[model samples]
Target: MQDEGIGSNEVHDIISAMDEHFNPRDLKVGQDVQMHFEPGADEGSYQLTDMRIELNPLKTLTVSRTDDGFKSNLEEKEVKEVIQAQKAVIKSSLYGSAAKAGIPKTVVSDAIKIYSQNVDFQRDVQSGDTLEVMYETHQTEDGYIAKTGNVLFAQLTLSGRKIPLYRYETADGSVDYYGRDGQSTKKTLMKTPIDGARMSSGFGMRRHPVLGYGKMHKGIDFAASTGTPIYAAGDGVVQRAGRFSSFGNYVRIRHRSDLDTAYAHMSRIASDVRPGTRVKQGQVIGYVGTTGRSTGPHLHYEIMVGGKQVNPRGVNLPVGQQLAGRDLKKFKAVVGEVDSQYAAKSGAAVKVAQRQVESQDDIN
Candidate 1:
């Protein structure tokens, strides 16, 4: 090696009795070489750090100075426009369902809005909570997401409360809310075309939240939270699913005998169960998301029955089982007396009201 004049900063490669190899360049300050090698031509050891080999991409390897060790701070989400760039990955993935189910892209956008209405979602949702949604999607001939889809189930899990809402039917030709236990949660049919809280924004009315111009609210707004689950307010099938720059993700559910419902602003949906599948009461259909014409997350629950608009709260739900003899008597007495007391008091805001007062009034 000395005869070859390989300097301290240089390296040597040879094919000989030892099949030996020498290091390249002087070891840097505080730097050392680690090696792996084969036995030499006769019996000497071969050194690895001195040799070059094809790179192995699968192996985990690192080379660094002592001044700093590896430090990794990686966030969970990414921003990619294409489908493959999806950052929110899940075991029970929702986008896959939209594709397979033939839901329109717009419907999904609406669903996100619907989900966002749950106030708690924006402030208190935990990492491990589950969001199970069932929605529909339309596809291109190539099986790509052509449009958004309608949500059949949108269930969100929080600390302890599980809000199970449904799109169900009564034995008598009417569709309305039903608890998962098959019990009715509805006091009556939504008098208007939409449900949830009082109209945050009204129909046929206009006032741009941003610009000073006035625009029609078209439908009503129901306050909720980001990531909150939205339900189909009645038994129906998805009519449209697509994205509208203004609407964001949206879904329209068409019901039997000329009834329909619309949900807007959603994050995503469940991977299984599509447009035509029948959904029962209290089904988790979609999650609230902010994607449309307004601020913050909330549901825009709209209903259209008989082609005319009406407040969802005032709509007559028909009557449930007609509270028979004993139950009927008890029910009427109880209900009537309370109404009478309220009518009598009218404006009594003294201390506070008590359930007993109402009960006693009913008994009388």
Candidate 2:
């Protein structure tokens, strides 16, 4: 307001009115602010009459100077939901492949989370594998994507085996990803608790990096940067969440079926997580860090079954709920619709690519 030469009193009144509809402190950096001016009493002078601030792509806050006082109103634009589909062959990583296909990172992350129940991205996802995803996006009147929604369908082809999962809501309003056979994609536990991290070490005998001696490594290590979010492997109650010997920051969750998952070497545990506190699957429990007796930033993850440590990759995790009868029938119809949409979108994309190629040939 000072830079724009608005009087202090007017600025204060304008802000007070704006606060009625929106918080001024919540303004994001680089957000758009528009000011309208009218002729002042003095010649060649202009006075501020109205101000508009873009809260987001879909919302705008407008403050107009009225005869009584300044008044503010929040204007929201309507958006239409659109379904989009993308298919890509993995050349190196799923992130890279999805980027090339113009898929949003959030959608790709959701797909990874859905598949993490059974597929190991680091080990199972190899070059030549294929990924297909169909998702929803809310677009403004101008066709700008305002928000990316859920992944309605996803498919992964590994070594010629195609695994397809469809998003469905049950009669009880529970939503989850289900395979073609109507089996929920959720397993008893996730194979990897964190995303975009490399497995530095596996469970078994290995030379301890800090100890400089061969030792039986009971837990698998995921090497990630400090502060990387660590997720709970499954829905469970926190058994312990504190510092321990050789483990900087540790969190242990006691899950069902006599299974327990432990995360070690966290930079900091989430404030809400504590002993006896129940946590949902894929919930963030802590952040990756080398807290105690460590060499570098990494997560030492372990799965205990019947009080015995086991390799997470090799463990036979129990499958989730199996849809049947009416639920299964509804899911099949959803799958068919998704498949049809994907096919139509894929065909359009192919035609667009062909047109680009022909246009380039003409230019040559």
Candidate 3:
């Protein structure tokens, strides 16, 4: 404001008023800022009258000179909720394929987390597998998507076997994903506790990477980037959380009287997670790192029964939430509605693609 020949006192007042509603530090490069000035009492001076800054696509912050001083207010634009569908054929990874299909990264992450309970992405998701997702997005009046809402439905086809899930809310307002049979997609434990990780090592007798000798590997190792979040495999109370010998920054959660899950080699444990702290399924526990006796950034996970380590993949996890009676009927109705929406959106997408191809042919 000073550079524009406006008085410093006026600039200060304007900034102070804006601060009441917004943080100046949040101003980003290329953001739109509008300023208005009026002639001041001095011969060559100007007074800052009004200023408006675009906070985001849906919000605007305005500061205006008032009788009391300068006043700031926030204005928000309403957005329309739009249901959309996207389908992708996996060429490499699910993330890559979803990106190619123009699916938002957050939506893909949510789908991965939802399927982690039953599907092992590293093993089950392969090339040529088909992934379909129906989700909600909030769009501005001009049809610009302001934000993504939730995944309404997700379907994965592996080896011609289709696994479909629908987001349903029960009578008690509990929301969960259910299959056609109305059974919840959740299992006793998640097959993978972290997202976008590759299994670097499996549980079995193998030569230790650091020790250079064959030994029984009690846990599986998932290699991911440093600071990647690690989630609790199931709802449990933290039995132990702290630095241990070879398992630096470890956390052990007791899910049942005889069942326990352990996560090791975290860069940092979540501040809220401590011994005796209860955690829900999919809650973040720590971040991946090479803190213990490891060669790279990864998570070492183990499941113990009767204090003995067992192969996590071999454990027969119990099914969760078998809907019956009225709940099942409601879920079936939800599934039918989601199916109709998905079909309509998908059909429109196909028509758009066909038109694009025809236009290219005509141009050629």
Off by over 4 Å in 1: 1-199, 270-273, 306-309, 317-364
True lDDT of residue 65, candidate 3: 86
lDDT of 3: 0.89
167 Cα displacement, candidate 3 (Å): 1.5
Pairs of residues at least 3 apart in sequence or in different chains that clash in candidate 3: none
How well does model 2 score by local distance difference test? 0.90
For lDDT, candidate 1 versus 2, the one ahead is 2
Worst 10 residues of 2 by lDDT: 312-321
Q: In candidate 2, how many clashes are counted?
A: 1
- Please give the CA lDDT of all the candidate structures: 0.44, 0.90, 0.89
lDDT top scorer: 2
Against the true structure, what is every candidate's RMSD? 21.1, 4.4, 4.5
Ranking by TM-score: 3, 2, 1
Off by over 4 Å in 2: 1-78, 358-364
Model 3 regions lying over 4 Å from their true place: 1-77
lDDT of 2 at 223: 97
lDDT of 3 by residue, 144-174 (tens): 6888998999999998999998888888886
Model 1: lDDT of residue 182: 41
**Which candidate, 2 or 3, has the higher TM-score?**
3
